[model samples]
Target: MGKALIEKGQIYRNEEAWELFSNLITEITPSKVFVIADENTNKHCLPYFLKKINFEKSPEIITIPAGEIEKNISTCLKVWEILSDKGADRTSLIINLGGGVVTDLGGFVASTFKRGLRFINVPTSLLAMVDASVGGKNGVDLGHIKNQIGVINLPEMVILDTAFLETLPSEHITSGLAEMLKHGIIQSEAYWKRIKNINRENKVELNTLIWDSIEIKKAIVAKDPFEKNLRKTLNYGHTLGHAIESYFLENPNKKTLLHGESVAAGIILATYISKDLYGFPENKLQDISESMFKHFPKQTFSKKDIEAIINLLIFDKKNRNGKVLFVLLEDIGRHKTDCVVSNKLIFRAFEYYKNF
Candidate 1:
């Protein structure tokens, strides 16, 4: 309860989220309440959500197949159909109860359904709670490309409950930490040092850390909602990171990397590039690299794998004028955006990551 209601959205921690949500929803009193979920949260999270809220009418529940592969136009059409069949209208309130995929796709459907329905986001996973839920960004992937099709729209309110994290997988927790680290890398050196102390002080509850991470992101998005300039700092690792994420997702032979896992690797490569291009301190790079490697095991990538990943960078959402624009760090807490990089440098960075 340190800082609730960031800008427009409401962020509650732990059990208090339920009462706040119940009160807020009861006040709005929508014509209908529709809850959306993926397979995982449907079975795991829905019961808790239903048990907490005292509704005038039981909300209709819609479940979709989970995972990134299910994020597409086809899946969206299915959600759209359910809303249409259920007579969801502008007065309807859609509650998205799940991780990034569920919240992302759910927001897209609700925003477009009848020219927008008021919706609430309840992010279950750490990724969603810290990064995905705070931002107004919502979209499904176009083919294997990540977030290529999405509109910018804030939810009526966002519900944050760490209780939902009890059922979350450990790997998903690690995945979200990558985003948390990015916040420090781009915003505050003091924040980065605190997170790096994870090795020494491992006893801290993730909920506290998560609150700080959300605050970091909220500070930036509050200034540049459209990602015009200041907000691009949020993409510190996402340019090549998205390319790596998309590459692994499309290749059957390669093990699929979680968004944050690929992002962890991308941050390493980008930091190396930053050192070469912007004089970022080598000691800082080493500490960041070691911390990331401690949590994420290195994936041995082939020469072809590197090339394929590099090629995918051209399709990055942050690209401009057919050039791959990078968000490089001049130092911790200092970022340089719109920087262009060459294939040769990317290859060298892969070599650095390999030997790192």
Candidate 2:
């Protein structure tokens, strides 16, 4: 079994965590229980879950598409409609049983239905487990800008099973690891070193590392739940990263960038900016870049494409008062926020990182 961090909700890890889920819900005896998952999790994981927890009363399962595109108002509307059709009452409990998309969108749905209801998160992806699941950042993407419409509402509990990692492909695993790396760079070098080689294959031994990321997030969230202050540090690589994700999202010929892929790019660009603006060591920047490249392949984005991506930052959710406030690094594990830059500079930063 793994450890548990009980904050906004409890996050439980290890193979035995499923047993805890059964114990907690059986005691509550919710009028109706609903588990929301994406297609990927439903196919790869639901069987194991059903075998573990023989629900005295069968729970409703809702599955949606398994990509960032699906995290939108249309999807939320569909979920709300599904719950209404299922006769879900105020007493119903929602279990978000997939990765970041499911947890974020499902949490938003639960929070809005009947004002609010109990919801648990069964984060099957490392990205969701370490970052999205811990923070009360429930939302759906709007157009190209990511997570544009959302609310902050904590889950009742979070279940993290390292065994689930075995089923994910390398790409999916890489996505989650990017967030873990971000967590390390933002707050804990020890955590970063702990997860330096964490991929799907080596996840079994990274349980403590996973919890360490969660703890870093917990500390950040506890200090700034509403994102009124230090919480911005969590967006370290997100400013330009979100824009890249958005830019490719609308292009038919170009492949879509996964949340973590865009974030990896975001961090790289931010690191470059940190070096240029803050005298961050060149060796440190190279180390950070090399670490990301080893895990995530660099995409060949053209100059035009880079410029287009930079333009999308205007729509980033973090921008306030027409200023693109970015979270930057002074060094690994040390983050600062409230730095604003021009659109041209954003383009140049992308170009610099793309080449460096």
Candidate 3:
């Protein structure tokens, strides 16, 4: 069993993860257990999850539609109603079992229902395991704005079993790789070097890398749980990435992007901006661009799309006053937080991403 400790939660990995989860269930011994999953997880992951542990009472399973589109207050209202109707009290435990969407929305639901309820996260996707589920930042998007309504509430524990990845689509796996790469770029040059040659076929290596990413994030969050300073570095690529995600989500013409896909593009754009402003090495920029493009297919953006994405920047959580703040890097492992970036630079960054 692999374990990592966060401020208010514990993370367990692999076979030992199940052992820890069973122990946690025995300890909590809540009045009831509620498992919240998206449709895909309900169909694919729930059975395996049920088989692994014995529950004194059969847990109630709540299934939401599987997608980012379903992560909103309307869904939360329905879920809250279900919890209330099912006679859930503060003693009930919520087990969020799925990817980022499920965990994010489920955590929000659990946190808001009757003030608060104990919850555990069982992150099934790479994105959720390394980033979303670990951080305790749970919330749903407001309309097209991403993660606009949420709270930072730690779960009792987080269970990560790579076995769930087998049920994910290839694109989703690639999507999660984006966050792991961000971890390397923002915190560890050594990790960056190791991740540059990632081989998904080698399960052992991939799992090890995933754990390293989680540790990097865990260390950062421990230092700055509230994103007062150091934790802001974790938003390195997300500022613009989220805007692009929201724009695509609202637009009818473009195919919606996965969270990691948009972040992959945002990372490349931020690298370019960093090079322009901070004298980040040109050679390293080239290498980074090549690496990102190799994993994520280049996304074509029109002038209109770029403008719309930029306009959405006002909704970024990191914004201060009216200025847009970005997390820029002088080099891998050297990051600048809350730095103001101009529209002209942003346009240039998009151009750089488009032509790269």
Top model by lDDT, which number? 3
Stretches of model 3 off by over 4 angstroms after superposition:
1-8
lDDT of 1: 0.87
Candidate 1 ranges beyond 4 A from true positions? 1-7, 199-204
lDDT of 2 at 291: 88
Model 2: per-residue lDDT, tens digit, 4-119? 42334767766556677777676668899998999999999888777877778989999999888899999989889999999999989998988889999999999999899889
Model 1 poorest 10 in a row by lDDT: 1-10
Q: Distance (Å) between predicted and true CA of 141, model 1?
A: 0.5
In TM-score terms, candidate 3 sits at 0.97
lDDT per residue for candidate 3 within 1-356, as digits (tens), equals 22232324768777777787887777668999999999999998999999987898899999999999999999999999999999999899999999999999999999999999999999999999999977789999999899999999999888889999999999999999999999988876788889989999999999999999999999999889999999999998899999999999999998999999999999998999999999888898898899898999888899999999999999999888988899999988998888888889999999888887
The pairs that clash in candidate 1 are none
- lDDT against the true structure, per candidate, is 0.87, 0.82, 0.91
User: How badly does each model clash, as a count of residue pairs?
Assistant: 0, 0, 0
lDDT of 1 by residue, 190-231 (tens): 889877665412434566678898998998998998988989
Better of 2 and 3 by TM-score: 3
Superposed by TM-score, candidate 2 places the C-alpha of residue 279 at a distance from the truth, in angstroms, of: 1.1
